[model samples]
Target: MMGFAVLLHVMAVVIWVGGMFFAYVVLRPVAAGQLEPPARLTLWAGVFGRFFPWVWACVGVVLATGLWMIFAVFGGMGGVGLYVHAMFGLGLLMMLIFFHVFFAPYGRLKRAVAAQDWQAGGKALAQIRMLVGINTLIGLLTIAVGAAGRYLVP
Candidate 1:
């Protein structure tokens, strides 16, 4: 059970963080360089349309597995170490950010694309990009905390 939990945890992180990396580093630059504003924005909208569902899944898995590990294995929230608490806090924050990005800017981007309003789509895409960059940084930090937290735990 512990091993399964660990696998789920790692896979969740990988999917979430890896998706962010692909969006920010690879897709962003490639779309910017290769496509016109309309095409680029439309492509981004399509990309997020596909990717956000996976992020939602990953978020659910991460939260479920993390809470299960804390409650079932650690005996409850009070039993969790400070580092685990920190990781959970930041991870929850990340999830909230993702929720905002998905429901707000991402939705706007999709609408703009559907309407063929390239400028509005670009603006919405920018909003999503900024939020995603912030979330990516937080996700990376959470991974660091997870890896090193045990040593720092009291």
Candidate 2:
């Protein structure tokens, strides 16, 4: 059970964080350079439409598995080191940011795309980009903390 939980947790992190890395680092520049505002906004809306659902799933699995590990493996938060705490804090922040992106900017982006409102879509995309960038950095940091924390935090 513990192993399964750990595997699910790691896989969820990979999906969420890796998706952000690809979108922010790889796709953003290409789309910006090759596409006009309309096409670009449309592309982003489509991309997010597909990716965000997976992110939602990842968030669920991550939270469930993380909490399971905390209570079952570590015997609750009290038994964990500072690194675990840090990872949890960062994860929560990332989740909150993602929720904001999905509910606020992503919604705007979709509506703008549907209405062919390039300016509004651009604004929404920009907001999403900024938030995703911040989340990506935090996610990377959380991964590192989760990986190396036991040795460093004790």
Candidate 3:
């Protein structure tokens, strides 16, 4: 049903985007201030290890629900509004960025933490911080677009 699909899609987006916001804004600052390299790095590595799985699952659910809504409820991509198209594009972009983060910097972060290589871990964390910050901003923008775009379009 449209209602169910919309609910799932929104919930998935909330989990992914809200998690990023919390990590980038709240956790990162407190962790950096309170913890030194080894502890900070360990915390992030552990945090990410736990969080990434949920994020990946959220990604799958969001994509599935979104497509279901578009094709089944809204009568395909052609029938959807520009807002839907924008949201779809932004969601795909976020997913691609997440894949890069998971494979590249996140991989290095895990390896560095395992090896107790603080320097490498720091570098990887910095990269992740930057990327996540960017993603968070973009996620917020996407939400705004999705929420308000219908009214704005005409």
- Clashes counted in candidate 1 amount to 0
**Top-scoring candidate (lDDT):** 2
What would you estimate as the lDDT of candidate 2?
Answer: 0.95
**Ranking of all predicted structures according to TM-score, beginning with the best and ending with the worst:** 2, 3, 1
The prediction achieving the highest TM-score against the true structure is: 2
Cα lDDT for residue 90, model 3? 94
TM-score of each: 0.97, 0.98, 0.97
Instruction: In angstroms, give how far residue 3 of model 1 lies from its true place.
Output: 1.1
Model 2 over residues 1-154: C-alpha lDDT tens digits? 9989989999999999999999999999999999999999999999999999999999999999999999999999999899999999999999999999999999999999999999999999999999999999999999999989999878
lDDT of 2 at 63: 96
* lDDT, candidates in the order shown: 0.91, 0.95, 0.93
TM-score of 1: 0.97
Better of 1 and 2 by lDDT: 2
The TM-score measured for candidate 3 stands at 0.97
CA RMSD for every model? 0.9, 0.7, 0.8
Instruction: Assess the local accuracy of residue 121 in candidate 3 as a C-alpha lDDT between 0 and 100.
Output: 96
> Model 2: which ten-residue window has the lowest total lDDT?
145-154
Query: Model 1, 1-154: lDDT tens per residue?
Result: 9889989999989999999988998888888899998888878887887888899999999999999999899999899888999999999999999999988988889899999998888899889989999998999999999879989767
